[model samples]
Target: MAELKEARVPDIGDDKDVPVIELLVQPGDTVKKDQGLVTLESDKATMEVPAPFDGIVRELKVKIGDELSEGSVVALIEPAAAAPAGDAKPVAPPPQPSPASGGGSEVAAKAAIPATPAPATAAPTAAVVETPTRSPPVAFDADALMPGKVPHASPAVRLFARELGVDLAQLSGSARAGRITKEDVQAFVKAALAGGGAPRASGGGGGLDLIPWPKVDFAKFGAIESKPLSRIQKLSGANLARNWAMIPHVTQHDDADITEMEAFRKKGEENKDTKVTPLVFLIKAVVAALKKYPNFNASLDGDNLVLKQYFHIGIAVDTPDGLVVPVIRDADRKGLLELAKELGEISAKARDKKLSSADMQGGCFSISSLGGIGGTGFTPIINAPEVAILGVSRSAMKPVWNGKEFAPRLVLPMSLSYDHRVIDGAAAARFTAYLAQVLGDLRRLLL
Candidate 1:
């Protein structure tokens, strides 16, 4: 006889009450061990919770958009005879302090699966069961209580709270089950500030006082409607808001005379398929510069600074809905032609909305090119964690001194926006200057 078992939410990391972004499986479906059962999206990353054992999903305890904590019953599985006992894989307990990922105390790098292979036979008579577990008594401590209660807030919200150092308990929860919603936190923050409460903490402990949410008078307009933002759109909005509000942004602009680069590209005498564009040369140049100054490719880790050696360059591709940055990992290792080919493929996939979540995951630096759209120069927001963002603009013909006389030369305008807290103005300017010099010289790019 097959034993029916509960499939509880495993320890994702240190976070509690993480929001379920998607449900990958349903009741009556046969799932292989380690197959993704549901996707939990925390602030830092989206993680897939896998089936611990081979089984048929008997019942689903949670649906899409549900917020779950550790030990929360996600589903019921009719485990095959070979499946291990419940004690063998006990559900991980709720975490005390959430990690950057906001899942649990133990960061589950990857989901664990039962070693035994699942049988092909299906069982149609399996029954589902649900049992309530006792909740831990509320903590009196301020810090512990705040995070424990605000688990449903997006990563940006949590980060905002952390930066503000405001106790979430002080705020009235407006979400279902008394979960602290972003708006609730913002309102509380605004009230606190207006009444002269202590300033919100910085980094992960502070809150942004409410900036009256955008509203529309549907009654006045008559028969108006609105729809919820998509997951990508929501995430984007949160990230942009957090970055813009928190980080001190400084933009430095410069122009690169790409006359030599263009002439070399027009000649096209080297290779047939390897069509080099200004962006490709810029990419190579940026990679070379990063090799010299690794600090520009780093991320902020609490009080300490993190410098990255690997150069995973993210190229921003415009889509119908929004912008997606698909990364070209280890850009320094790839030649100009190879880089161009990969860029073309990835950009096409992004525009077609065919790029997977994994395609947009990691990047040490980002390039937002408006050159294709005919922009002169625009300051682009830094894709957070990365300290800087490079913007590429259209190359135009402008008069420049050619040693003896003034001559019209093709020049490209570039903008660099860096985090003022981490990168100094001089360093940013030098980095942009280095990028400009590299783009101007075609020989170095080819070599």
Candidate 2:
């Protein structure tokens, strides 16, 4: 003989009049001791009412959205097989499993319980077996959630994240007890769309169901030889890919009249042993421009902007292996002649593979010069952690109208690439204009 029992809601704090958000089982379904029978949601959290003993569900006492309270009868359960008529005494329900130790065993025990689950109570696709409840409504500890490490959020919040296709694990919740909220999900979605941090749950395709890159047999076309990429190329290539993919890049193109600066630079190149390149003067001007517009020399740290006080400019040097930016520390402190000498030494070291890791660290801004090679203009990727980069193109004599008459002047084309998250378009334009002014009249650099 089987004894009949009711699965009543357990002691869930002071919360009352909570609603049944999900019903896990119905009449005729078999459940194990401590298996979740109904999912209840309070304003603050979500939890499930568990079966008190292994039994067959006889009748549902409540429906979805019904208000519930502690000790409220949820379902009528028929106890497991009886031992003759006496049955020794009524067997105690299985002990509640500790979240850490019994996560795996809980699955096994629930599996043993017959699962003739009724139609999905939550959604047509929603599974309603022994409800895989992650945490009880009162259990604010995120670790108590179900499965192996799903981020801690309420059932409703989890559903919200799923609808937005945002992964909860990637987000650090702002709510108390590290609880993820609907607002957190919305913010993450916005950030992903803006190209700042963490990607969408759809494999970061930016909502595109893109096809994989095709693989081809190159030797089939003609004779071919394959060579492995150098270590620097491989490393920098990955960083470039990540930066371009995650950072919203915007480039502002402008021309600088470096005529006077060029004349001064050529005068110093007459020395065979010591050569002063245009880059030395440009470096000095860049430092001054940074002082004028501090935002240009800042990085995006989460929601805050980190403004750097010191100017450690990075110079992008092209080598046979790949492109590497060796930083010049304290550029504000070094004079034009000293900068030229240091640049020469570092360029030589970079070419010979003699530059140490220390020689390439701690940069506030970066400059990539394609002037020597030849290009009207080009966009340089911001060397990350540094907000902006200046790309210097070839200098040409372009005729400019000096109010009254057109005069030919040596014009240097430069493009400023910056992380749009930190510096706006207007600010970037101003920074470039100031740089061009300082370069045209090297005297302004003194200010």
Candidate 3:
């Protein structure tokens, strides 16, 4: 009789109570040795717990949303006997996060170095003759993927097309049974380029003035596969593109000394009615700053500047689908605990795909916090209609000279990106400085 084996979470460096984001296997599934059982996501990385040996899963020890750490049991397995010598190896290498890619599966990560474009070669006659009439490129359409009418292609091929911004509906596949492949997409792009079908510059009606996006056959260099962008990605991609192109953005960088505040937060963490997070404090501090600098809380509407009296703050939540900013209404009226509770609820709703349009609209300012995720600083894009957005990165202890001698201080990095048309550099600098001051002393929020 095969002995029962426990599949436990391996050493997941320094991450405690990481949430189980996905389950890769079921209790009844027959899993190979080293096959992933469950996926855990921490602030720094996402990793999967693997089966210790080839086995039939008897029971899952953990479920989604369960907090797990190193040595935490994931599943119970009944080990399988040794395989025959002539059998092919069934062990799959564990997926490792690609250092170069911001965040995605290993298969989604494109080559770090650009694969040299396949030399100019004569295309298959069908590929050249079947090119679809290229539409005049304008702003990226959020619904351009045309979910209503999908093309005949593998998920990997579809993903490749999406990455290249190639509309699959238009392409004619040369493959068997009218199936579109990566090669087909590549050929369509080459034909479009050779035919001078590149999109016209934004604000310029003249068509085909810009160089077409590059077409490359990644398979020539090495192994490759594609992963489709989430639905949120499709929508957000178009909006982000429009915002980046239309807005004249300026970023102001500053640091906040939060040594005392951090200490206070930790001390109060155990006593808070609803768990108080750094983000709760940020929301309060931002409200205070907005009150002092009311212009930052206003939006530009055609020729008018609409100043909002009620404080609604948009918190950029990183959901598995994509990034969604849900508004916390009347943030000025809510206490820290209330804000914290609401933040938690809204974030949960975002991740669960439960947020409505109203949940995202009517924001005076937006905050994108990457503090939980490790980052020194990043210029966050200003969510449109909101004139400014605050980006918070991970805090670190650093030596700071306090009048006489250097003292170790916890410093939080902030990047404030503002619409240059609405906010001047001096005002932007002043706004950040005041925000930092408020964050340094949470007491300032009371005033």
TM-score of each: 0.54, 0.60, 0.54
For model 2, give the 10-residue run with minimal summed lDDT.
Answer: 83-92
Ranking by lDDT: 2, 3, 1
* Tens-digit lDDT track of model 1 for 1-447: 356798888887788878986676766665656766777877776666778887667788888789988888988898743333332222232222223333332211112221222234632112111111223444322222122323444445555665665655455556654557778777776665455564453433445445445777777968866777766677777788768876889999999998988887777637767666667878888998787778898998866889987899999887767778899998988987888889889988988789998898779999999998898888889998899999988899999997999999998999999999999999998998888888788566555
Best by TM-score: 2
- Provide the global lDDT of candidate 3 against the true structure: 0.76
Local distance difference test values of all predictions, in order: 0.72, 0.78, 0.76
- Backbone collision tally, model 2: 2
In model 3, which regions exceed 4 Å deviation?
A: 1-209
lDDT of 2 by residue, 9-40 (tens): 99999999999977777676656677677888
Task: Name the top lDDT candidate.
Answer: 2
Q: Per-prediction count of colliding residue pairs?
A: 22, 2, 0
Every model: Cα RMSD to truth = 23.1, 12.7, 25.6
For model 3, how does the per-residue alpha-carbon lDDT over 1-447 read when each residue is reduced to its tens digit? 346688898988889999986677666566666766777777666676878886567789898899998899899887644222112122222223344535232212221112222235633222222442233334422122212334656556755665565776667777765668899888866765455564433323222223556789999999999999988999999788667756789899999998888898898889757788998999999999899999999998867999989999999999888999999999999998889889999999999999999999999999999999889999899899889999999999999999999999999999999999989999999999998899888788877
C-alpha positional error of residue 341 in candidate 2 after TM-score superposition, expressed in Å: 0.5
